[model samples]
Target: MLGFFFALPNALPADTRAKMPGMFQRTINLGLDLQGGAHMLLEVDLTSVLEQALENEKETIRQEFREADRLRTETIRVDSENDAVIVRLRDAADSDRAFALLRDLSKPVDPTSISQDKTTRVEKLSEKDFRVTITEANIADIQKRTIAQSMNVLRRRIDPQGTTEMTIAPEGDDRILLQIPGAKNVDDIKSVINKTANLSFNMVRKESNNEAAMELARRPGSLSKVPPGAAFYPEEQGGGLIVERRTKITGECLKTSSEGLHPEGNYPIVNFTFNIRCARLFGDLTQKNIGQRFAVVLDGVIITAPRINGAITGGSGFIEGSFTLESARELSLLLNAGALPAKLVIVEERTVGPGLGQDSINAGKIASMIGLAGVGLFMWLSYGLRFGTIANIALTTNIILIAGALSLMGSTLTLPGIAGIILTIGMAVDANVLIFERIREEAHLGRPPVNAIETGYRRSLAPILDANITTLIAAVTLYFVGSGPVRGFAVTLAIGIVMSVFTAVVVARLITATWLRRKRPKTLPI
Candidate 1:
């Protein structure tokens, strides 16, 4: 009865399922192979993460030097190819002082290993030039930490509500494996993950002349020559714009975001609010730069650059662009989930259609029915009607118990799992066969029916336990060492092994004992 209630949800209609009690509504979940879904392999762009870190380090160096009155440099640049920061001192005499200051600025390798470990080693290229190369150990550590953080963020973004049975796990040092069951739209999930969603506001760099702006735009390689503290980002609406690299506000300050319609244009937009501290800072920024153009940058593209008409002190704002309703909602969802630490590239994508899944499920059902029928016929024919009927009853109970256990545990059922179930049916009957043959031997020895049955079960206990335990151990090992479909097979095999033991030994014994008490026959049915 408990098994029936537990397995009831799978056969009920959607509306009927909702009407059922929660305890009776639990059902076994289907795997990607059974129900169809999306499979995605994403690789994190670790190089981009390193480059961003280098940029931050460069900014820190500039700020530290600016605060120090005596330190002076011609230019501070990050050499990505060489993986080092170059500090060109204006005067050769200042090299020693600059190196000492910069060395202090570099992070300590370890607080305990101050003397032995240093994050950066300063090398004097020439009297006026010094290079600080970051340690390889530090870079590797950053990559490891970034990948872990990226995996966590990806999981949160993909399964925000946590209702879906999805698998999001790290594949390698820089890759993520995603298997989402019942996910119909692969592109939707991909788009959410691919967007870094890093939002920032920066003031547009005012050019001295149109020729300078056009020249910088024409020569993409001349981005390094844009200015001392500015970046070149192409505008979403038009050509390009040179913007201040220093962020006035970032998405970290954002409290919440939602999709909404633009007040004036009625187009889709993302409405956002900031915390008190950021709201005050934003108000001050807009107040000071009323006539200056402020660029809203997402990832690297300039979404919009509009002049600040007046001070925005409401602590809220809206972003308007060429966004449809769905796009606006997606952007809001990404913003609400927080931004990814690094960009994710979809290296592989596979969409399993529901039709294929249905076909596989049908084939599995047909195979399972055939196996069950064949096993049942052999069991009944070999053992006469009385004992054969007892084994059949135990077999039926075993199936129900397997389904009930799976439903209760919320495990997924795959095609391989169905095969495990079929295998379990054969194994269950094998145990009964051993016990029945023992009973027949004891009956031939002139033992009474009840005594023969008792002795047969007692003697068969060791062998039954030995066989099931060995199989269970193998199933457990497979579960721990394998993945995906292999794991599914292991889970079902393990569960079926346990349930088969119960039905074969305890359940069948109970049925035979009840029959013996009712009809005290002089001879055994076998």
Candidate 2:
């Protein structure tokens, strides 16, 4: 009864549902495949991820060598082509020590999982030259981690407002599948997800000993091949700045950001606060570097580079670029959402219109009706009216229960999900058929009507339970191994199976029991 009441809203028009009470207003969300929406397949740049991982590995080697033996390295550079790190020792005699440090940095590919697959394979090329090759297993692990992280970041970036049912899930080894149900603005959707918004505060090189930065800046190249101690940040407006390679503040440290007007210029700005730990570190960085400049970098582009006039002990600061009101709010939103680990390149894009979606919905309805009617008619013909009526009642209740559960759980319903429901309608009668067959056998054996009915339900209970349990296991496995609409189908099927068990075994039994006590028939219907 409660299920029927909750499922009522779905039968009404949009205007009628709006007028209902808050609790009754809920409805199952239509997924991207069932509604007009944009579908985008994005591929993660594994090259950038590998380069970043190798750079991090190089730094780890440098730190371990310094702390373990105080051994100085002449050069430690990432070989992107080979996905390896080569380290040159200042003293040839420290080769063994350097090798040991690199070896210590090596660990299992997955510390929590397998112990056999190593992350790094360390080898000494010469007396003073050593190369640490990142194993393929390690790269594969990194790809998984990067993809997972990017999915999380993309989820936040894509739907901060929570306006629609959006699907953001990993597609393959290096791809993300994004589906925005009922999304109209395809360009806007693309723009938001494409923005990496990786923010970092890099200290500007005012006076540096390394002429590599000067030489690199004069060359005017990308940030990847800058000097060892400096990073080249190109401004969004024009030109570029050479800043310290080491980042003092990053987007990860940001606690929150809000749109605000600048104090002097009255222009829109993004006011940001660092987390507790980064706040202290940021304050110290600002205090010690007074009168120096730092570039506010976003996605390898300089947003602003302001000079530190005095000690900023407060953890809060504002970014003032040529931002309008909307852009400021967007920047703040992006900062709060965090950064994507690797760039997402669009591999494919598609859009489905509402006309096609309505056609799908109509077709699904037709198929479901045909299936339900055929099954109910067959049951009515095979068994007597009394037995078939009870079975049909249970089947109807099963569907109501599915709808109510879907509505309450807020699960998105896709075309595949509708198929699951139709499949479930067919399965709902399995218990009844078993019970009817058992009752017929008992009646043929000369048992009384009430005795045969009781014996039928009792003897058929084991088979019914076994069948449902195995089907439930299959549904669970499908859910675990699948994503997107596939999972939707699994969820709908699983829910339907549960409801089918309830209606068939419980609801149908209760109705039979009521009839038995009232009519007290001398013979069984089956």
Candidate 3:
């Protein structure tokens, strides 16, 4: 009865559902095959994962050699062609020491394994020079982790509540299978998933802000080398700014983010707050760099380069760019969920239409009525009118309970789910059939109607429970092992089985007991 109340909301119109409580607002979500939606095959950039690892290692080498040995930044350069970092020491005598340092920093390719293959392979390029290349095992491990993280991040960004029934799974070595049901706009979703959202604040090179330097940076083929720990990031407005690659605070420090409008301009902006630890860090960073300017970089592009006139002790800030209302909301949504591990390139994109058209759905409804009517008619003919009427009522109640449970659980409904519902209708009466046959046998032995009904129910209980329990186990197994439509079928079928038992044993028995008590029939109807 409680479930029936919950199921009632699904029948209401959208306007009515909105007026009801949140608990009753959920209707069964239709899958991509039933409702038009976006479909995408995203290929994870495994190479970008490797490149990212190399960038981190490059930073480590730059910091160590620059501080410890006073080595010039220009001496250490990334060997992009060879996929390695090349370091040149000022003193030839420090060669052995630097090699030892590199070896010490190198970790096992897989920390869980003792395979002896190290992540970094350091070799002497020349006297006072060494090359550090990432091992194949480490590259593969990084790629695998990227795919896993990408799937999780995508799930959180697209379907945080887990009710959208979006499918995000590994497709191949370096690809993700993505399907968003009822998502009308493909481009919008693509934008949400594609952003790396790696936000950071870095100090700008004071000299780079000058007109001559700014013009030089803007030239198409200037061929200027960026400073060791700094890169030229293009500002949102027009020019470029050379900013430090390292940051004291990163996007990982953010606790929450929301979309808001700029106070003065009323332009859309993303407001962010940091956790306690990062709050103090932000305070100290701004306090220390009060006279200098810092660049807010997102995915390597400088969004804003505002001078720190005063310290921001509050640990909160807003991100502003050329953002529309929709984009700002999307940005905030991504920030709250967290950044993607690597890039996702949409290699395949399309919109899927419903598998069953409106006419086909109408036909299905008609066919369902005919089938149910036939089943009810057979039950009425086989058993007497009173008992068959009770069985049909129980069957009807079982379906309502199934739908109610499904709505409450927020499971997606598909063609396979509808098939499961039809299957439930046929199986709903199996318990009644068993009990009825037993009652007929009891009547043949000259038992009274009351005694026969009691004996039949008591004896049939064990077998009915045994059969339902075993079938329930199989349905659960299917749910666990399957994906997509198979899981949909399993979900509906399992819920139906449980509801069938309730209506059969609990509901049918109650009605029959009351009728038997009031009427006080002497002879068995069968």
Candidate 4:
């Protein structure tokens, strides 16, 4: 009963057991271990991750400590090696107060506990000195968010998705690993991932008001105001961002989108549906300002700024620009992928080719079919048809759960990943065999059928968990260390082990329980 409860959650649900209207379970995906293709390892550049974080935080810090500058000019510099921000005053008059502020920033580390000299503020500061250190927690957060965002963004950048299988996940505290089985045009991925993806909405600076612009510009970080009814267009890779008005609407308003042609001409356009919340905001903005042009900017460039013909209360609109069909599709994908919590830097990249990925898929399929057939035949030969059929039924359920899980995760199955699935299939029955053998032994020892079947499952629980845990450790370690297909193999294998444990222990037990209740057998076949 304990084992059944423990494993039940992992098993396939009643509804999932039903295959698609016509398709069968045997025809599913196979990963790259059995199929061969490109296998490459990628590491996220944490150096860049920390640098971006520092760059973003630099201005905020200056704002916070701006008052302290009254005593002397002070600046905060990030020391990447030590992962600490060093604050220095132009002169010694503010050093004491600087240290006091530093104390306030320090949470767990007490500044007074450290040795200090009367001559100079603590000679050196380590990562422990900072309030928020770029340790695993910080790195983990950046890694996870980056990977998830990158997945959606990259998928968007690629149109008419092909037979490419790739896995992206956190490799370590500050690194991400990407694996592609048939990756060929790796440079395409590089181009996609290397972008900073920094987006902003600011009032465009007008050249006619050079004096005001220069004054605002000279204010160091101040943004310039746009001339009334005028727009600013900066050249390629221009110095900074400028907009006419604060964006009344952003990408968040977009609920659904589709690519289409503009009504007036051949130019590409993106039609979008906005949520009710945004619909109200947009309606008010458009209704209030009928003649204003709203800039549709992406990244930093002004993509389009259509004039408000009238108040749009329908919650649907189109973005018209001098875009081609391809560009329009890509734009729609970016909008659909959603906004990022923080800007992302591409530290790694890879691309899988359809040709290579297809070949790998074929190989993986052959290997999986071979593995399944071998396991099924062996089980039938070793055990009688009755018991063997039941084991195969559980194995089928295990595979379904794995497939459903992969689909749910939106995970791409690679070649080595297919090998993992095959290995899982072979090993999944070990628990079932253990339980069956235990039942047989009990039957031979003259125990009643009901007691023997229940006892078999109850006793096998501990050994099952112990065996799977050891393998899980190896799988997790390989997932961290090895790249590409290796990680794919690890992911599928780990998932399979979990699914197998459930189907073998719980699903098989349920079937046996139902059978025992129905038959009420007096003598059991050993």
Best by TM-score: 2
Quantify all predictions' global Cα lDDT against the true fold: 0.85, 0.87, 0.83, 0.63
TM-score to native of every candidate shown? 0.76, 0.91, 0.84, 0.53
Instruction: Report the lDDT tens digits of candidate 3 across residue range 1-526.
Output: 6888889987899999999889988887777767768889999887777887888899988877667654443377788899999888778877777888888889888778869888889999887788999988888888888899889889988886676888777887999988888887777688788778888888888768566456655772453556567777877777788777877688889999999999999989989999999999889988988889988888878888888998898989898888899888878888887889888889999887665434435665676677689889989999979889999999989888988988898888876787788888898899999888998999899888988999998999999999999999999999888877788889989998998888888899999999998999887665
**Candidate 2 residue spans exceeding 4 A from truth:** 19-23, 59-70, 114-118, 208-219, 222-227, 236-239, 309-313
In candidate 3, where is summed lDDT lowest over 10 consecutive residues?
A: 355-364
lDDT by residue (337-398, candidate 1, tens digit) is: 77888888889989888898899899988987888888888888998889999999999898
Top candidate (lDDT) = 2
Cα lDDT, model 4, residue 311: 92
The residue-level lDDT of candidate 4 at 370 comes to 88
Residue-level lDDT for 470 in candidate 3: 96
Model 4 lDDT per residue over 1-526, tens place: 3333223333545465354332222123334333233333444444655676655444444545665556443445566776655555666655566556644443322246553322112332432232324444445555566666655655554432644554455555444555544444666556545553333223343353466444434453444354432334442333322455344466767888778987878678988888898888888877877866555666656665556789989989787766689978766766776644344444533344566657766777688888888998888887777678889989988877887676555455766677888899999988888888888888888888998887888888989889988998999999888866677789899889998999988898888888778978797654
Best-first order by TM-score: 2, 3, 1, 4
Greater lDDT among 3 and 4 belongs to 3
User: How does residue 290 of candidate 2 score in lDDT?
Assistant: 95
lDDT of 1: 0.85
Clashing pairs in 1: none
Off by over 4 Å in 1: 37-43, 90-175, 178-194, 203-225, 234-249, 252-255, 261-268, 273-295, 304-317, 320-324, 338-355, 381-384, 408-410, 429-470, 520-526
